[model samples]
Target: MGIAGRQNGVTGGMILHRTVVLVGMMGCGKSAVGRSLAARLGVQLLDSDAEIERAANATISEIFARDGEPFFRDREAEVIARLLSGPPCILSTGGGAFLAERNRQAIHDKGVAVWLDASVDLLWERVKHKDTRPLLRTDNPRKTLEEIFATRVPVYQLADLRAETLPEYSIEETTDRVIEVLLTRPDVLEKT
Candidate 1:
């Protein structure tokens, strides 16, 4: 059952006033933490990347290969907008989703962005074994990852709330930290 089953089951009935958007660089555990958080809150967990892939009937890498990044980014923005218009839920977006000003504005207007902060080394440790990450398919993936990390850190800082992930924390612990951050902003999430 884990933390989700252990948490007060009342979370399912609690009112979510706005979407909780998880924004961060790749390997920051946004997807893992988002899933745990949604289970703990008993709300829908939406992943913009997964939604885009489902809508396009292709993997993100395929979408990028055939349509290019500009097209994929456009589709990403559309997916984020469509999802945000729905009921409040937990949204785990792609690492680059927050890089666009338009997406940032949409998230700010309809949701609360939570930046999951992890050290670059920690991020590398988690992602080094993953081959599915489209953006890391480079001759020097580590340097590429570092470059992306440096560029995205500033933008991620613009999120409404922040949660830190340590090497020792489990996914549920990270989700709990995110919940603590959300609790500080009743406009986004409230205890019922």
Candidate 2:
């Protein structure tokens, strides 16, 4: 039975009550964990970055290089709003998505924000080899990541829920932790 699916507290099929928006720093496993959570919950997974890429017909890096970060952020906000307004599902937002007050307000209004928290060491290990992150493509990428991480943690903590990630945990383990957190909020995920 799905985690939230229940009738009189007995396991059955779940009905998603609200969108679960995953917010965190890059390499924090938001996408991977969100995908697993959605599958486990029998729901769809909406990735803001992928959605933005599809809408713009360009990669995030391409958009940044061509139109700049402001333009990319504008598109990101639009995609996030569109996704949140759609249905109750798992939404994985880009690392910087929750940094904007407008985006945070929208998420708070329409969904439950779950910050997939991970240490900078773990995040660095995960993103060190990835070229897809535009913000990390600096001469000193590690330093850049550190700076971004420092600046974003406070904002991410504003999320309604927090799912901490560790290098020792597999994707399933992380997803399980997230589920535990979500279940604590009956309005977000019921026992049934």
Candidate 3:
């Protein structure tokens, strides 16, 4: 029993009828919430970033330093497209994944993108202690993060649906919110 059991007018385990692609800035809990969402749905969570790392045998920061952002982004697009063509599951993408029209088009074609909305303050708080963020290695990370947020929010707004991530909520609570939002689109999620 999961979302299907909890949602009104529904019965049985959750049936994820289409791929749910989680898109948002780094540290917004896409991976964390995807884990919970997948568990509730009885499916696997595929993280595009992890998939890329596995394929390349290198961490994202390593790839960024070796092949640069452009090459890494190209690989990201390929991985996203390939994953979306697979079975229905939860897919968590990188912070910048949805910025590309090609990736956006691929997601629109085979899956639905769910933007995990978190405020700049929340994102900064979550990421400040993590040195793994290559994009934030600038002279001033907070300022850089704010700049990136400003540039990407408009593109993220194009997601098919959005679920908020608040500082007051636990990962499970956030996952539930995502489930509630997904429940609104029967084509993407349902009870079977």
Candidate 4:
């Protein structure tokens, strides 16, 4: 579904007090858009993957290869929990984080979840050259992305809000769109 249609469910004048959590596939501009959005909103920004990497003393790729995906997911959940336990802020979660029900519930209970929706073509165009993604290290990166996109799109749809991250737009524009969503649908930002 398109972003405008996705936003129809959020209406009425409700205030939002929780953090804004960005959830989507890799290369959907969560980190960049989130940082800009947080700055514009005058809130702090935290990247869960970066936090996990810092805590593990290694890159996400290294962590995955060394400890395995299960271990990495466990650590990711822990880091996300820790980050969410703190004050309201903008959090950019790992692409696969929201695939887990525990993490999804945590985000739902703790913040306003915004799914940065992007088409498979857009995602591929943005991420095809990035070697930092462990999941993309396959013989065919396009196929890998397509697989992940198919699986994760439905999962991301469960988010409280949805915003399109067009390649033509700047990060500031994406952030502005998110800000507009938050301001228009404050109910999604309510603390639980």
TM-scores across all candidates?
Answer: 0.90, 0.88, 0.89, 0.84
Whole-model Cα lDDT per candidate?
Answer: 0.88, 0.85, 0.89, 0.80
Q: Write the per-residue lDDT of candidate 2 for residues 1-192, one digit (tens) a residue.
A: 534442122223445677999988989998788878887777778889898888889888889899999999898888899998886888888777899999999998989999989999999999999998878889999999999988999999999999999999999999989988988888878754
What digit string (tens of lDDT, one per residue) describes model 4 on residues 1-192?
333422322223322367789989988998888777665554678899899999889999889889999999999999988888886778888788999999999888887789898899988988887797878999998998999888889989999888888878889888778877776665544212
After superposition, the stretches of candidate 3 with alpha carbons farther than 4 Å from their true spots are 1-12
TM-score of 4: 0.84
Q: Itemize residue pairs with steric clashes in candidate 2.
A: 4-192, 5-14, 5-192, 6-192
TM accuracy, model 3? 0.89
In model 3, what lDDT does residue 9 have?
Answer: 22
By the lDDT metric, which is better: model 1 or model 4? 1
* Model 2: worst 10 consecutive residues (lDDT sum): 4-13
List the RMSD of every prediction in angstroms.
3.6, 3.5, 3.8, 7.5
lDDT score, candidate 1: 0.88
Q: What lDDT tens digits, residue by residue, belong to model 3 across residues 10-100?
A: 3345567789999999889988998888877777788898999999999998899999999999999999999998878889988888999
- Candidate number of the best TM-score: 1
Q: List the residue pairs that clash in candidate 3.
A: none
Please list the residue runs of candidate 2 whose C-alpha ends up more than 4 Å from where it truly belongs after superposition.
1-13
- Number of colliding residue pairs in each model: 0, 4, 0, 0
Task: Name the candidate that leads on lDDT.
Answer: 3
